[model samples]
Target: MTTGIVLIILSAALLHATWNTIVKTAGDRTSTLGLVALGHVIPGLVMVTVLPFPSVESWPYLIASTVIHFGYFYMLGQAYKHGDLSVVYPIARGIVPALVSLWAMLFVGEILPAQAWYGIALIAVAIQISSWAALRHGVGRAALFFALGTGFCISGYSLVDGVGVRLSGDTLSYWAWHSVLHIFIVGFIALRRGNAIRALPRRTWMIGILGGIVSMTAYGLVLYAKNFAPLGAVSALRETSVIFAALIGFVFLGEGNWRRRLLAAVLMAGGVALIGLSI
Candidate 1:
């Protein structure tokens, strides 16, 4: 990976973890989704005035991505409701790289080096270990299954966004429109339930908005990075945000079962290194 992509990935790692922690710790589904949509709303609405219009060809990709992201949101909200952050977050994010690697290999006309393959295997192991840490802490089978379902949704949309951005030729507009659609879908759901708008605390709103900004920007960066880098590498680096979230949970949320988590982190870092080195 180039220095620029590396920095973008690393920076996105922090932002990804930060926003996930904010949602897991302070924000409920309504708060999290609302803030996330708001994050896109502010930046996306402003970009409408500041940036030139995207090609008309980009519309289909934008619209498809929006639908996929809404599903992602629904699965994620349910995952958060049912599982621990360490378990849900890693498994959900972890599924993205594997499926994306397979998609890139089969469809994107990209070939992975042998070392990158090794990295993919390492990533597989890291995901297992990270998941084991959650189960070791007593996360049950049902919660684990829900987290896997959520991970599948994440990987599905991530693949969509990865191809969508590169082919669309306008990452910002793709994300911007996707965010707009998210606001409509998530907002509609919240309105129907009458949960988010009426009773959410002010602090949750603040956390949601901040988390949204961090999250939207992270998505933008990853989509932009995939324009020039390998999908597997982009996905791997993004998953390091799991480590960041783990640390955030430990420090801020006072989670202390560190031995197994440390092992998972090492495996994850090694996997990322192997992938990056293959580049």
Candidate 2:
């Protein structure tokens, strides 16, 4: 990856972490995630008006991605409900790069050199290290499973979008259509909650919507990066969001074990540097 691509992916990583932090701190994770999904819908609506429709070839990936994204959001909301940002976020984000990398090589044939592979391994290890305190103390069986589920959802979408954008011939169009599906997913959740959507506070609504915007932009950047860089490298770099999420958990959410998390963040930074240099 070029320096420009690295910077873009890193910016996306930060934004991704920011939005997840927002979700983790929300009053009701499910509802907040719904609002976040709504955030994707508004921009998607605008894009649909101006952008050309995606090609027939892209539709399969788009449809599959939409279904996968619904599951992703569900798993994420549940994970945050049952675990802290620092604990769940690292595991969830940590596992994705390796899975995405493996999928890319086996299915997409995007090969990475040994150096890049080393960087990916380093990043994954650092992320697991960051979660050591929680793991050592026991994060509860429920939270562990939910977090793992969230990671699986992330890996699913990463691979789907990696190919989906390239096929669409218009990156923005693919992103818009993929995001618009959020409406159905969020609407389904809202429906199940009855009139609770109306009862949600204005602040919660605002945060969710804004966080959704950030989340969309973050992934949009990643999709663009994938066009320029290897999918595995891009995915691994994006997982740096776990470190950012850890800091957000520490500084904002009042989570503990900052010393360990920060140390892990430093190691993760080195791993990212290696990935960038190797690229």
Candidate 3:
């Protein structure tokens, strides 16, 4: 990947961590999650109106991606409810790089360089290290299960969008449609918890929507970079968000051991450097 693409993906990583932090801090996670989905929907509605529709060929992947996101959002909310952001975020994002690499190789026929694979392995290790304390002490079976489920959903959507964006002819249009389709996720949450959602404070709504905007921007950046880079490399680099999440949890949420998190960050940075150099 080029320097520009690396920087773009890194920026996305930061934004990704930021939004997750927003969700982690929220009092009503499910309602905040719905607002986050609405965040995507609001911009998506305007963008779809103005942007060209994604190609017909990409529709299947688009729909599939939206479906996967439902599981992702659900698992993420559940995981947060059961564990700290520091614990849940790392586990949830930790497994995605390898899973996306494997899926890309098996299904998409995308082979990454050996060095990139090593970098990916290093990142995977770093992710686990970031969560070592939680792992040792136990983050609860429910948290572990939900976090793993979230990781699976993330990998699924990553591969689908990586190929889908390439075929869509226009990355922004594909993203716009994908964002608009988040309406289903938002609607589902609303239907199940309409009374609760309706009762959330205005401040909560604003923060959640803002978080959604950040999340949408992060997704757009990753999709744009996917158009230019290998899936495995992009994903390995993107999973650096776990490091960012660790820092956020420590600094903002007052969670986790900062010393261990620092070590993980250094290791992840080395992995990132390897991936950047290999590409």
Candidate 4:
């Protein structure tokens, strides 16, 4: 990937970490997630009015992505309920790079370089290092299961969107539609907890919506970058969000041992460097 694309993806990673922090600190994860979905829907509604529709061929992937995202959100909320952000975030995102790489190779026919593979392996290792505390102390079994499920959902959508956006003819339009589709998530949450959602504090609504916007922007950037880079490489680099998440958890959420997380972050940085240089 070019320097420009690398920078874009990294920016997305930071934004992603920001939003997850927002969710982690929320009073009600399900409602907050619903509002986050609404955040996407509002902007998406406006954009779709002006943007071209994604190509017909991309619709199936888009639908699949939307379905998978529901599971992603559910898994993420459940994981956070059971574990710390530092623990849940790394395990959830860390597994994505390898899974995306494998899916891209098997289904998308994208073969990455040896260096890229090594970088991905390094990143995977660094991610495990970041979560060593959880392993030692034994994170809740529920947290581990839900986080793994979240990882699988992320991998599924990442591959789907990577290919879908490429075929859509316009990245922005594809993203706009994808954002709009999040309405289903919002609706699902509202249906399950209509009274609770209606009773949430204004501050919670504001924060959740803001987080949704951040999440939307982050995903959009990744989708755009996918148009220009290999899926595996882009995903490996994007998993840098785990480093950002670890720092956020330590500095803001007061979650873990900073020194160990920092070491993992440094190793991840090395992995990112290798992936960047490979292209």
Each prediction's TM-score against the native? 0.89, 0.94, 0.95, 0.94
* Model 4 Cα lDDT, one tens digit per residue, 159-255: 9999999999899999999999999989989999889999998888888898999999999999999999989889988888877887888888787
Displacement of the residue 50 alpha carbon in candidate 2, Å:
0.7
User: What C-alpha lDDT does candidate 1 achieve relative to the native structure?
Assistant: 0.73
Q: Model 3 off-target regions past 4 Å?
A: 78-85
lDDT of 3 by residue, 83-137 (tens): 8766787787888999999999999899988888889989999998988987777
| Model 1: how far residue 123 lies from native, Å | 3.1
Off by over 4 Å in 1: 137-142
**TM-score, candidate number 4:** 0.94
Q: lDDT per residue, candidate 1, 1-279, as tens digits?
A: 777887798688888888777767663565566666787777778776766566677677677777776776677777767876666766777777777777778877777888887887776677657557565677666666777777776666767777777766567777776666666765665676555555877777777777788888888888888887888778877877877777677767778567756886888778878877778
User: What range of 10 consecutive residues in model 4 has the weakest lDDT sum?
Assistant: 130-139
Candidate No. with top lDDT: 3
Of 1 and 4, the candidate ahead on lDDT is 4
Question: Candidate 2 deviates by what RMSD?
Answer: 1.7
lDDT (10s digit) by residue, model 2, range 62-122: 9888888878877876887788666787788888898998999999998888888889988
Candidate 4: Cα lDDT at 265? 89
Per-residue error at 255 for model 1, in Å? Answer: 0.8
2 versus 3: better lDDT goes to = 3
